[model samples]
Target: MTSLETLLRNTQDVKVIDRSIDYNEYIPLDLSAFNPELSKFDIKCAVSFEEFIEKHLTLNDAKVAFGGYNEQRNLYQRSTVFKDEKTEERNIHIGLDLWIKARTPVLSALDGKVHSFNFNAGFGDYGPTIILEHQLENQIFYTLYGHLSLDSLKDLEIGTVFKKGEQFATLGNAAVNGDYSPHLHFQIIKNIAEKFGDYPGVCSKKELPFYLENCPDPNLLLKITA
Candidate 1:
């Protein structure tokens, strides 16, 4: 039997963003200053998340800013969701973030039915989020699309089905999308447990191992070159 990882790796000819955008159009953004060797920038100075993303896109000369899989980032400093007295700081990002303009079409990575969705509104929350359930071969899994426009969730139902590459959601602005840049936070889960419209896209150092196991790298299926 083919393993879930291998199966995802074998999936061909698919995209979560506009099909016309080429790999070259995707810019690898390193928001994390975890690596001392890597050059760092102050994104906090930007007036808004929209300005921050636009500035990076202009600097890189690309339409899309993509990255943040297992990357330790300082971007979570603004939200208490990642840091509270009870738990250690959750600074490691486990999902792929595609930074782009608001209202940019977001497509399904695969054929799946909407399992659950909710407006996770907060300073650093997912905002309008959707989780899709899918079964490949004999295995079951889920894909989450976070930081989506509220309009995307207006008409969606729990069992609504979306074909592969079907545009189901649009990117949300900073006001609604966790007060950050407009980006699609995509994550894959082997088992979602009882979580509904929300899951931990970022984890603390102690929880990293478990999350890493449950939520594999989304690039395994996206094949988006850095």
Candidate 2:
């Protein structure tokens, strides 16, 4: 089978906080307009992305984009880890963002272990992040949840066990989560490079190709409108 087929085969139905929609549900927002390169103006026209896409946006657009490749928008692009002097330009967004209000509960899409976690704080940072590892159809992979409340990772133990569709964390607001509109940055990583709690959600133009392969569209697992 082809990689596309593999991805389709691996796609899983995620248990949303209180999902009322059904399969192949039509999301409210037309985020196809949310390309990585678009300026704040373009993004706001769509909806206020809790992180990179700044400015005022409306709630008409619910159910944010999960995973799908785009050449313009960097989900975590504007988040800064520290003072500008402390780090270089922040550009890469390593995960798929689920745009919504803060405090939304994030659920585990599959049975897995708490592989690792940390509070990746900084300007435009992840705030609190969690990574869960799963073995579906004998395929070993991981899911990374970023932009969560600090309390979310307070007592999480690495390698701790969590069942599929479990409640793990809640979406945080801009004050706690990396400075952005409220949203959950979801990502699937094949190899974590020994990294815990934090990973590059976006990559430079030169590195896009590699990051794309390393981080597949989370839609495979979440089945979100990518």
Candidate 3:
């Protein structure tokens, strides 16, 4: 394992969502093209897609539906942001998603200062996003929180310090959060490269290897297992 991965794994009790919800209540959700169930729903519509999420949670008897790291999904086909005639479709999701109802409390994964934040307004884009810069074991990295409520960005400033588990934001609904189900798109970025508030959460197959290396699996920190 790399130094960053080891540092993340060595940490304890990391919860980015409501602290009251235990990891046991979190269930894995498959939004990939390989999931045959996705074919049944008109996922392009946020309302319909949300209904599907609600049903999935109900059936599994879980509170939160999570996953989608390095998952290739067909859901992005409706958005020109992921694909246009000139570029290859960016269908692979590189972040760990925590699917839940809107306005759920979002916490900081570790003590860090705000590197950047923005309202990336677009279809299939991260609505309100925040990236926190952290340093551990003399290594600096960043954690990105996407699909946040607008209120989360209110009164925010650069270099804002947030302690681990501190409530810094709330989840955004479909109307604001890229017109999809309410979820926190969390990623661990080793190198941000001049990007502010926003980073490419989806990548084409051709660019997968680079992204996969730069953005490691967030589960190494969350450790929410099956």
TM-score of 3: 0.98
lDDT of 1 by residue, 1-226 (tens): 7778889998887788777788788888777756552334444432455666777789888999999999998778768989999889999999999988889999999999999999999888899999999988988999999999999999799999999999999988877887777889999999999999989999999999999999999999998872
- What is the C-alpha local distance difference test score of candidate 1? 0.87
TM-score of structure candidate 1: 0.93
CA RMSD of each candidate after superposition? 2.1, 4.8, 1.2
Give the winner by TM-score.
3
Q: How high is the lDDT of residue 47 in model 3?
A: 93
Give the per-residue lDDT of model 3 (tens digit) for 183-210.
Answer: 9999999999999999999999999999
TM-scores for all predictions: 0.93, 0.75, 0.98
Q: Can you give the lDDT of residue 156 in candidate 3? A: 99
Error of 3 at 89 (Å): 0.9
Using lDDT as the measure, name the better of candidate 2 and candidate 3: 3
Candidate 3 residue pairs in backbone clash: none
Question: In candidate 1, which residue pairs get closer than 3 Å at backbone N, Cα or C atoms, i.e. clash?
Answer: none
